[model samples]
Target: MLRHVLEVLDFLDSPTADGPGTIGILERFLGDLDPSTSELRPLLETQRVVGDRGGTDFVTVTVPGRRGRMADGEAPTLGIIGRLGGIGARPEVVGFVSDGDGAAAALAAAASLLRMWRRGDRLEGDVIVSTHVCPDAPTLAHDPVPFMDSPVDVATMNWYEVRPEMDAVISIDTTKGNHLINHRGIALSPPVKQGYILPLPDDLLRIQEIVTGGPAVTFPLTTQDITPYGNGLRHINSILQPATATDAPVVGLAITSAAVVPGSASGASHEVDIALAARLAVEVAKEFGAGTAVLYDAEEFAKVNDLYGSLAHLQTLDGARDESVLDSMEVN
Candidate 1:
């Protein structure tokens, strides 16, 4: 599993390859949750820009939020949103556009849009584009190892903010507020401890092999899989020592269990209920070639509470939003 995952990640991080193909593999690996039945509707949106000869294509998804819920028809309830985007190419187009940062931003916005939908929320305005540029590819970059240093999991929520552009893409009737979920942006580099520089170049590869292989791999990560003190604060602080001084960024990782389900106790729903916290930990760990799996507790929850109101008030929808509306209206 580690090897397979590494193969995909290596391609994604590679300067030579645009990130789309890698994302396709990820979508395939994760499998598709039903649009209507599962909590993963807006999880992976495939886009295609058609031209005369050949066009461009790519896939994108949003980052999980803090303590995310993975129930269907839901988005992350984390208040803020995060996105991950990538560009791909074809044999015809040699150097296609690589809008990794753009892709990430879109994903974030998509998550937010979804969230707004569940709340019956409306966006403040039309969709807007925020620009970002990728850090130039590492010059003397070597094959980096991939591992799950910690076991991270995922959580998700419903309710996203759908912008005008996404509405154009899906051809949905935006006027009616059918799809309200959208993501914001992504935090590119996570703060985490960097492991010792391996003695041999192959050492990194070995780590990648073990982590990508999953539990069967013989590596320290599985045996050491557990959330660190401070929920990873100490580890992040430790790893960032070298990078912090020179403005270098330290990438840390953690893992947990997560799943996407449909519906919740709060009457929220999602097409893709991704467990963001755990997923972020796992992805960051994989970037560093660590080993670990975040375990998650999956259970359905939705309980209604008692409601007390006058019979007349109960009949009018306005009373729900403003209780005074009930007092002002006279019974027929």
Candidate 2:
């Protein structure tokens, strides 16, 4: 298990960290550990301490309440905390206490186990059942560069409750190549609308074309879906919180293009550059390793719309416009 942990850490550092080969290597390494051996626990504890000292977050589970929000009047105590340490006659059994729909309760138990086994923040209410294990996920305690953010179940994990949107939700977007117009909206050019919600090979091909100059090239794209885990969307919302740019004096725009060459035939390609939308498109594909759309104004969208089509064609387009001109735009 120690070697397995070290391998996981190393893979995480690699450019293609979570590739299939890396996963196979990890599985094989973990297989070497004897489940029957009693040495595993102490080694894990030692590693946990070492990781913590080396600036790695160690996983710990704390169930402050079994039912309802902790701040609410009906919060219940988590009955089993030390059982996971294998301290008693029946040490393998980690305790669980949940009060909710049967599914939610079961999910909470799993979440509690995950928290105990992995380093993460406490959830607020009972466990949100939808989140699944993400081995290389970024800890909430330390934000990483290149912004490796993904949605996870957020309910019952206490800190998630700080945001009103973290109550219960599911992560809808799988293709990590997405941009936010603001918080909840995504921009889509016409070509992307065809398969926005429906997964299509053509749609993926479009993303590939823009990414590589010719066609889709085989590369790594981390894919995880916690829809089966409870409160999925809430978890995603927490993970995808907008970056606060204190130094930038830039305006946001929503733009769409239908006849664009080599981009997802269906899916939003959120764009954000007026002067160099095309160049930015290439930069986005190359730098972030994702296809991107250029942001545009209402008039620009309309002009593009007049040239190609109308914004009304897009089903998920959030019609958000920067009504204030560049001069009138104020940054506080």
Candidate 3:
């Protein structure tokens, strides 16, 4: 699995990187395995919005589920997004493509799945992968840390990346903004389903423990993190933004580090940790598709919803922007 991750890194770490380039590299590795079963789409809308700011190439790769076969459609479909502003924070960050671990991990997982399929080890459901390629992205300041700013805002990204067919999503991002989860591997966020932030699934924890051979680690996600951005509200990051678009359960697969690493910083990615996250995604796909790994308990969830009315408004869909308050207050 780590070999696959390294292979993806080699492809995305280049300076002349773009969506089609990523697809071309990945296609070389994966195209041989029943090309009809997979589909790849690259988008160029990022440049339209960013213009002189930067260039982003959005690419979506999907492995369709086969009906009646091991890889079938009846099972749940999982969407894994390598959420990031750009793979390279060019000029600003030198050498390797900074801010690209999320994309790399997602691509590695996709490649791994394709390899497994080629070897006759097929999953029960389809797996959808989406991410953008941007070499020269902007850097923005924030409290406690700085971040890699995307050329296009969050709304544009959600429109293109988040889809209705996905029953569940795991938005993978480099979460080193704060000092919350002090580890060098991965952390899972509590499932955000139907705009409600549910408790962390025990099954996912079990999988993490089994995968890492240690205690399961988690990130401290706040209500604002699940809410849609552009509302001028504070958020942990864009890891949970997918939940704002769909009613399906969304989880954050954060690749972390012991120290606070800026998203625009090069040499920040850890191959070992990335491999772990990719493996977790593959494992979750297996369990989720087989109806074994449940993200939320149906009975308990309904009870919570009944106990507390629909808090779906916090998803930022209904909340109107109050910029006057934003102007008065000193937002850091």
Taking all chains together, each candidate's TM-score versus the true structure is 0.24, 0.18, 0.88
Q: Is candidate 1 or candidate 3 better by TM-score?
A: 3
How far residue 34's Cα lies from its native spot in candidate 2, in Å, is: 47
lDDT per residue, candidate 3, 1-332, as tens digits?
Answer: 89988888887777887776777766655545444644332211222233334446777777655531224347888888888877776677774544678888888887887777555676667777777777777788987778888776676667668878788888888888778878888999999987788888899999999999999999887787888887678888898988887788898999988888888888878899888988898898888877789777777779998999787787665574222322222211
Q: What is the C-alpha local distance difference test score of each model?
A: 0.24, 0.23, 0.76
How high is the lDDT of residue 87 in model 1? 26
Task: Please report, as a residue range, the 10-residue window in candidate 2 with the lowest summed lDDT.
Answer: 81-90
Tens digits of per-residue lDDT for model 1, 239-299: 1122211111222221111221111011111111222222332332222211121111111
Give stretches of model 3 more than 4 Å off: 33-52, 67-72, 317-332
In model 1, how large is the Cα lDDT of residue 128? Answer: 24
Error of 3 at 137 (Å): 1.0
RMSD of 3: 5.6
Between candidates 1 and 2, name the one with more favorable lDDT.
1
Candidate 2 lDDT tens digits, 1-332 = 22322333333323232223332432342234447854212111100111111111122222332233443524322211100000011111111101001111122233323333233333323222121122233312211112222222222221211223222111112122223222212122221111111122343345435533453322111111111112222222222111110111111111222222111121222312111222222222222211122211234434554676532322111333222222322211
Rank candidates, lDDT, best first: 3, 1, 2
